[model samples]
Target: MLAHQQQHAVSQADLSVLSLLTQDQAPSPAQVASSSSARGQPHASTHRSKTKKGDGRADVDPLLIAAAAASGPDVTRNHYFHSFFPHPLAYSACDDERAALNASPPGPSTSPPAQRPKMESRQAPRSIRLQVEEEEKRRLERLERLRREQMQKEEEQKGVLQDKPQAVALPTRDGGFDFQEDGKVQAQASQRDADRIKAPKPGQVRHLQDDSLVVLLRQPSTPPPLEHPLAEPPFPTVGAQSAVKPESPLSAPEPTAAASPEARTPLPPLEVQCRVRTRIPTPHGHIFLHLYTNNHDTKEHLAFVADHAQMASTSLTTNAVEGTPILAETGERRLLPFIRSHSLDCKWHDGETDQERIVRGAYVGRLTETTHIASHPNPHSLDPTATPPHVHRSHRTTHNTSSQAPTDPPLVRIHSECFTGETIGSQRCDCGEQLDEAFRLITLAGRGVIVYLRQEGRGIGLLEKMRAYNLQDLGHDTVTANLMLGHGADMRTYGIAGAILRDLGVAHNGVRLLTNNPDKIKQIEGEGVKVVERVAMVPRSWVLAEEEAAAAARRAARKAKGKVSGGDKRKSLDASIASLQSLDASSRRPSDSRSTSLASSAGPSGYSSRAPSDIDGELSDGDSDSSDWDAKTDSSRAYHLRRAGVGMIGASVTSSPELDKYLRTKIDRMGHLLNHPTQQGTLKRVMSSGGASTPGATHQHPLSESVTSLDGSSGEAASR
Candidate 1:
C-alpha cells in the first residue's frame, strides 16, 4: 500500500529527529555515533545501546530507536512488520553501515529465495486474489507431499521399497503437514493401547481392592474407545448411509481374527423404568412395588415383582372369581385408588377427561369401561420419563421375539438391604434367610423379580451397618467388616434392576437368578438382564439345622471314634501306645464322669483346637472332643435354623459359641452365600435350665422359662 504509506512517512520523520536528540544531554555513544541524520543518513552503531550486562549507561529508548528505524529492514521487504523482532534495521547500521546493508538489493525484498509478487488490491477485489490463490495451491501441495516423502525416503534407503501404504493417513483439508506422531507410529499406537491405557506409575503403589471392579466401579481412568484401526469406518454409520455399494452377491463377511474385544466394545448402557408401582403389603407375600427411575442411580431403587400376571385380579383378589372389575377391565375403575399402580399403558385419552386420564397413567385392559376420578393431572403425567401408551404393544427394547418365549426365565432377586437382616432379626447375617428365601421362591414361582436394593449393609449403611456390626463383633469378616467400614466388597448395583426389568416387560426371556452372588449374578446379568437360572439359596432353616447338626456331628464323631469303651478298642490315634494309652484312658471317661469336663470344655475361642498333642492332635482334637461330649449329654439338641429375635417372634436361637462365631465370619469372611456347614462346629454356651449349671454348665430350659429374669438385663446384642 504505497510501501505502507512510505513507511509511515519515514516513521514521522524519525520521530522529528529523535525529538531533537532527547532535548540535548545524553548523546555519548560516540556522540550519537558521529551525528549525521536529520532524516535518512542512517548509520548509528557506536557499539553501545546493546551490551546490557552492567557498565550501566546503555538504556537506549529515543522513541525506541525511532520506531525501530521506520519499522525496520529499511521498510520494503514487503513491509508487513516481518518478524525477527530485533530489527532496528538489525542494529542500526555502522560496521561500514552493516557492510553496505548486506551488499545491497533489499528494496522489493521478501526472502526465502525471492518472494514479493502479491500485488492484488482493487480495494481487495476477489479477496486478495483468493488469498493468493489459496497460498499458491497450498504451496504446491506442500511440494508434492515433500516430494512424495523424499521419494519414499530414497526408496526405503535404497532397499528399493516396493508397495506399502495400505491406506491409513487420513487428515487432509489442504493438509499443512505437521504429521509428527510416528515414534514407530506412536509406539504402535501405544502398544495397541497396551490393554487400554493402564496408569498407576508415580511411586506406583496401587492396591485398591475390595474385590476390585475398581472397588465396584468407581470406574473412569480413560479407556473406552476400544480400538478401531481405520478399515474405512471412522465415521458415517448411523442407519448406514449408502453412498453407493449396491453390488453384494453374498460376500462381505471378512473381519475375522475371531472378532471380540467384546465384539469390538459395546456395554455401558443402563437406562431405567417403572416410574411408580405400589402394592407393598409384606409380611411374606404381596409385593408388586417396582418404583424405579434410573439413568444409573439416586438411591430409591427397588423391584419385588412376583408376577402372577400381576395378581389381585379376581376383581381385586376374589369376591369369589367375580368377572371384570379388575379396574373395570382397564378403564381404571375410578382412577387408581388402592390397587398399587398397574396401568400397563393401554391408552385412550378421549381428549382427556377423567382426572386428566387417571392422572395421566392408566390403560392396560380397558381404556374405557366406566371411569372418571374428577379432573386435574395431565401436565404431561409429570414426566416420570413419559413414553406410556401401551394398550397392547409399544414398550419393546429388551429384544424379546417370543416364539412362545419362557425357556423358564423370570425369578430374579438382587436384594441388598439388610437393616440388621430384615428388621432386627440379625443373626449377624443370612440377610433374613436370603430375604425370606426371596419371597418364598418368588411366591412359589408364579413368576419372579425382587430387586429391593436400598443397598444397606452391603453398601454399608444403618450407621455403617452398626459400624460393620462393631467390626463384626470385633472379629471382622463379611469381607473384613466391609473393608474395615469404609466399604465395597459388594456395593450392589444392577442398573436399577436393569431398569426395573426394562419396565416390567421382563427384560427378554432370561432371569431366574435369586443368588449366591457371583457378584450378584454378575450385576444382574447385563444390558437387559439375563442371568438364566442360578437359584441356589440354601436356607430352609439353615438347611434343616445344618443337616441335623451335621448328622449329629458326624454320628457323634463316628460314635466317639467307635467304642473307645473302657474296654479300649482304639483305631482312632492310629492304635498302639497300648492302644493309644487305652484310647487316652477312654478319653478321661467323660472327664471322669464330669468334674466340669475339663472346664466345661472351655469357651472364648473364635477358633482354636489344640487339645490333641500329636497323633494329628489325636485325630483333630478327637473330633471336636466328640462333639463336646455330645453337647454335654444332649438336652433335646435339635438346633438348626429359625432365630430372628430382637422384639421377639421366632426368638429362641441358642447355638452361641457367639452365634457360631457369627456364622463363621459369614461363611469364611463375608462372601456369605452360606453352605459351608458340613461341620465346622465350635459353639456351646447356652446355660440356665437351673440345675446342671456349675458342672459342665448344661442349663437347657428355654422354651421361655419366664424370661429367666430377662436374661440378666439383655444387650450383649440382646444376649446373642
Candidate 2:
C-alpha cells in the first residue's frame, strides 16, 4: 500500500518534482481530472490526516479516496469533497434477479432502494434480487486483493533479480577482474577471499561509498578566486601551499590566450651606448671602423660589422713555422676569434671618405647571406675508397668534392658608384641609372655578385667631391673643376678594385665583366683578368621611351584604319616627336664653338642622309650630329646642346676668376677671326637636292663664349 501510494504520489506531483524522482512519471489521471473539472482553482490540498479504520469514520469509496491521496501530500482534514455513485442493493443477488428487478418498474415491488422503507416487505418482492450489494462488494474486494498480490509478487521478483551478482566493481586501473579463475563476489560479505579488491586502503587510493561501489575519479583542481598567478607567492616546494593559485602542469606553465611577449615578460635591461674600434685589411685598403653599440647587445653589433664591408671579426695570430708561400710562417698572420670588452668613452676620427663610409655603413648587416649553398659534384669520380682530387674549395664553400663539380659563376658587378648622382638623383650624369641596371641584371642572374665599392666622388669622397661639384656648377667643365681642386682629371684608379676582385676569386679566366667605360674595359682586361664579355648597362628611360613609342604607333595605326584620327592623336604624335627631337638636339651640342659654327656652315648639307634636311630649320646647327643622330628629332639635339652648355659654363666659371679675365683678353686679341669678311663657314648651310660638303676656303668660324669655356679647360671628356 505504501509503495502504491508512493508511485501514485510521483505521478500526481508537479512534473519537476516527479522528474527529480522517477524522471519519467507523468501526472496521474485523478489529478488531470481534477484540474479539468475545477478549471481555475488549484487542485492540491493541504493538511492531510490518514483515515483510521472502523473508528465511526464516514464511509468513503476506496478508489476515490486513493485518487485524492495521489494529488500531493494528503488532504483528509480539508473541507473539499468528492462525489461518486455506488451500485444499488437490488442488483446484488444474480443476473436473473437483476433482470426481474429492472422489469418490474413502478409497481409495488418496483420501488427504488432509497424510497423503500424498512418494513415494506411483501415477501420482499418474489422476483426481487437479494445479496446483490454484498456480492458486488465481495467481487470488488477480490479484484483489489488480486491486484495487491500481483504487485507484491512482481516486487519480490524484481528484488531477486536486482540482488543477483553482477560483475564485481574492481578498480578500472586493472581491466575489470577475471571471473573464471578467482570466482564471483557474494553480496554483503566480508571480502576475505577476493584477491584483488579495488578500494582504498589506509594509504593507497581514495575511498568513496563502499556499498554503492562508485569509483570516483579525482583531478587536481584550481584554487578559489582569492588570488591571481602573478600576485600569489610562488610555490616554495612541491605540494606546499603558498597561496590560492591556478593549476598548472608539473613540467610547464599554464596556457593563457591573452598572453603576448609584451604582456607576459618583464622589461628588458637598459641599453648602454658605446662605440667600438676595429681595423680591417682588404685588398683595396685598410678600412678602420668605429661602430656604435649597446653594451648589452652582442648579435646586432657583430652583424653590423659583418655587412658594412663583409669584414669578419678575426684576431691576429703568429705561427713559428711554415713550409710554402701560402702557408703560415714565422710572424705569419692567422685569423682567430675577435672579441673586445665594452666601453662608454670612445675616441672619434675625421676622414675624407667619412660621408661615403657612413652611407655604406647604414645598410650593414641588412643584406641577407647565403650560408649553406648547395654543391654540385661528380659523385662517381670521388670514389669512396680514395680522397677526392677535384675539391680545392675556398673558405666560402664547405667542401671540394670532385674535379668535375659545377663551378659557381664568378662574382661580377658593373659598378657606377657616383655619390651625388646616385644618391641625390643628379641628372648631370648617368651613374645612378647604370648602377640600377647593373644590379637588376646581377639580381636576375642570381648567382652573380655586386661589389658596391664606396669610391664616391670619384674616390675623392663627398667633401672634396662637393667642392669639385661647386667648381663645375660655377662654369668649369669636369676636367677644369678637378684641376682647381688640386686633383688631376678623373683622379681614380682600379688597382684596388682589381686586387679586391682577384681576392674574391674573380680572375680574368672566371669573370664576365659588365661596363661601357672603354678605359675601364682596357685597364681591367690588361690586369691579368680574362674579359670574357662586357655587359652594357642601358638606361631605363631609353627602354621605357621605346616601349611607349611602339604603343603610340600601334594606337595611331588603329585610329587611322578606323578613319577616326582626331586632333588629339595628332597632338600626341607631335609631342612624342618633339620630345625625341629634343633628346637628339642635346646630344649634338659641340664642346667648342668653332666646331658648332663649322657644323652650321656645313649644316644639313654635311649629312649624307636626307633626314637631316627634313628637320633642317626646325633646330639649331648646334644640335647637329653624325648620321647616327638622324633617328632622333631636332629638339632632342637641342636639349643635349643646352645640357652640355650648362655643364661647360659651370666648369669655365670655377676654373679661376683670373683665368676667365685672361680668356677675355685673348678673345679681344683674336677679333679678326671673329669678324673676317666672306667667312663662308659662318653662313648657315641649307641642304640641296644632293648631299654633303666640305669647309669653305679662306674663312674660319669664331668660338662662342659657351664653347670657349668648355674646350679651353683642357683634356678630353670621360668616355662612356
Candidate 3:
C-alpha cells in the first residue's frame, strides 16, 4: 500500500514538468535528454544502485522523496538539484522522510557523503552530455514505474494534481558555489532569451555559445565614448592591458589606402610666366619672343609672339608711377595663376577685377616680313652699335607693321632648344633646319606662335646630351641612352606650353600648329586653344641628297655586273672604275657657265638654311677631280658612289660617312621627324624598303609642307 501511494505521487509530478517544456523541445534529442535528466539532477548513482529492485508497479521515485529509508540509501541534501524540481509536495516529502533517512543511511559509508556544488556563474557553457544521459536513464526508470502506476490506478491519478504541500525553508544564495536563487533565475532567463533568437546573421561564423569564434582575430574597437564613466574602455581586457597601458596588434589603427603614384600623390602643377618680351630683328622677320621662367626647374624659356610690333611700347615704355613692370607684375595683379607655378609671392583680394587681373600682350601674323637690321658691337666692344632698335627708343624699323594680325587661328610651334644646332653648323641633327623652317613658315603666314622651351637634348640639358652623343657613338640609341642616364625617353612636358597659350588670350579661338609628332597635337590642343590646322616643316636639302646618293650607287653596281660577266677580269675593274668616274664627271662637271661662276656663291654657309628658294644644299666643289674616289674595284666604286651622292649638291666638305650616320640616328633613334631617302638610312627604313617599289617615310614636294611617313623604300633615284 505504501509503494502504491508513493508511485501515485510520482506520477502526478512527472506529468506537471512535461507539460511545462516547449513543444519544440519534445523531439530534440539533446533538449529531451537535458529535460528528462531533471528528475535525478543531483546524482546518476541513485537509479543505477537500485537495479534488480523490481521494475514493476511496486517501485517509488527516490527524487520525489527526500531519501530512501527502508529499501535503499538516503538521498543527499543537494541544494542545486532541488531548485530544478520545485513542486510543493516534493519538499513536504523531504521533511516527512528526513528523519527516516537519518535513522538508515543510503549506503554503507565509513565517512559522511560528499557535498555537491550547488550553483555556478557560467562564463562559457560546459559539455554536459554525460550528465544528461545519466539523468535520462534514471528518468526512464521512473517514467516506466509511473506508467505502470497509471495503468493500475487510473482513477486515483485525478486527485493527485489538485493536492499540494505547504512551502518549506529554502537556502540562501552565497555569491560562490554555495546555494543561490538568482543564478537559477538568471540561467532560465538567458535560456528563454536564446530560444527567441533562432539563428546568426548572414555571412557571420559565430556559434550559439559564450566562447568566441577566434579571439586572436578580434580587431581594435573605436575610441571610447566621451561621456564613458571610466577613462579606460569597459571591454574585457586581455594580455597585459589590465596592469599596463598596452598597444595591441588588434588595437592599432588601420592604414589608409594609398597605393599608386598617380592616385596617392599630388604633383606640383606646371607653370610658364611672361617675364619680358623683347624684339629681335632678323633678315626673314622681326621676331618678338616672350621670355619666361618656370617653377619646376631653373630654366629660362621663351615663346615668339606673332605680329606684336604695335604692342612694343607695352614692353619698352618706362612708366614712372607704375613702379612694377606691366609684363609680369603691374597694378596689383595678384591672382595670376602662373605666378603660383613659379612660386612667386603674391596675394589675391576678394574684390579683384577680371580686367585688372588679365595679362595681355600682342599678336603677330604669318604673312608679314620682318624688318632686317645689322648692329655690329664694334666687332670687339660690348655696347651695341647704332641700330633702329638700340639707338633711339621711339624709332622703329618695322616690316609691314601696319598690317593687321591674321583673322585665322595663329600658327604655333613648341620647339625645344638646341644650342649646338642653332649656334654653329652642327649637321649631326636637323635642329637648325627645324628652327629655320618654323620661323620661315610662321613669318611667311604672318601670324603664329612658337613656344621655344630651353629644353636642350630633350630636357636632359647640354652636358647630358653630349654624354648621350658619346654613348650613341658607342652604339646605343638616343632613347636608350637617356634611360641608362636615369631619365625617361622624352621628359618634355607640354603643361607649361598649354598654360602660356591660355594666358595669351589667343587660345579661345584655335591655333594652327606646326609639327609632325602626333604627341604634340594631343598636348597643345587643350583649354580655349584647339589645333584648327596642322603645318609640317620639311628639310628639302637632306631629302634631295639622299636620293642623289641612291641613284649613283645603283649605276655603279649595274656597270660592274655587266662588265664582270664578259670573262675579262681586267675589264670588270675597268668598267666599275669607269662607271664611278662617269658619275663623278656628270655630277661635278658644270653643265652651264653659271655653275662655274656660282661655285663661290655655292660655298658652305652657316647651319641656317637660306630661304624657301635655296632649300637644296648648294654644292661648291672647286676644280678638283681626284682618282682616289673611283678605285679599280666594284666595292670601291660603290663606296665612292654612295659618298659622291651624299656630298654632291649643297653638302659641306665636312659631310662624311660619320655625318650621314649621325643624321640617320637622328631620324631613327632620336625620333627626329625629318626623313632621309637613302639605303644608308635607318635599318627600319632598309628592312621596310623591299627594293624598287616602296615609298619613303617623308618625301619632298616643291611647295607642299605635307609628307607621308611611309616606311617602305621608293625606286632608286634618277638624275636629269
**In order, how many clashes per candidate?**
8, 34, 21
Model 2 earns a TM-score of 0.26
- For each candidate, give its TM-score against the true structure: 0.27, 0.26, 0.34
Task: Note each model's CA RMSD in angstroms.
Answer: 28.2, 38.0, 35.5
Higher-ranked by lDDT: 2 or 3: 3
Q: How do the residues 37-121 of candidate 3 rate in per-residue lDDT, one tens digit apiece?
A: 6554543333443342455544334333222221112124453256554322223345434554466555775754333334565
Query: Judged by TM-score relative to the true structure, which candidate is superior, 2 or 3?
Result: 3
Clashes of 1: 8
Q: Give the candidate number with the greatest TM-score.
A: 3
What is candidate 1's lDDT per residue for 48-100, written digit by digit as tens? 12322244454445445644443433434344335543333333423644665
Candidate 1, after superposition: displacement of residue 68 in Å?
4.6
* Model 2 lDDT per residue over 1-720, tens place: 853453334223244332322322334765455543433233332101122233444423334533443433323322122222122332233455466567776657735444222323465543344566667889999999999986776466445434534331222233222111112345453453243354524443322322222211121112122112222222111111111122232234332211222333332322322233343432212333333222112312211111111223110111111210111112333221111111211112211111111122211111112111111112212223211322111212223334322232232553535665556556665565454434333322222434444445554456866786677677755545544555433433443344334333344224444542334544554444445443333233332233334445655776577754458545754664464343333222212221221111111111111122233322222222223444466644533332233222112111233333322322222121121112222211211111102112112211111111111111111010
User: What is the Å distance of residue 253 in model 2 from its true position?
Assistant: 77
Clashing residue pairs in candidate 1 (N, C-alpha, C atoms within 3 angstroms)? 329-366, 330-366, 345-390, 346-363, 346-391, 478-670, 545-640, 689-699
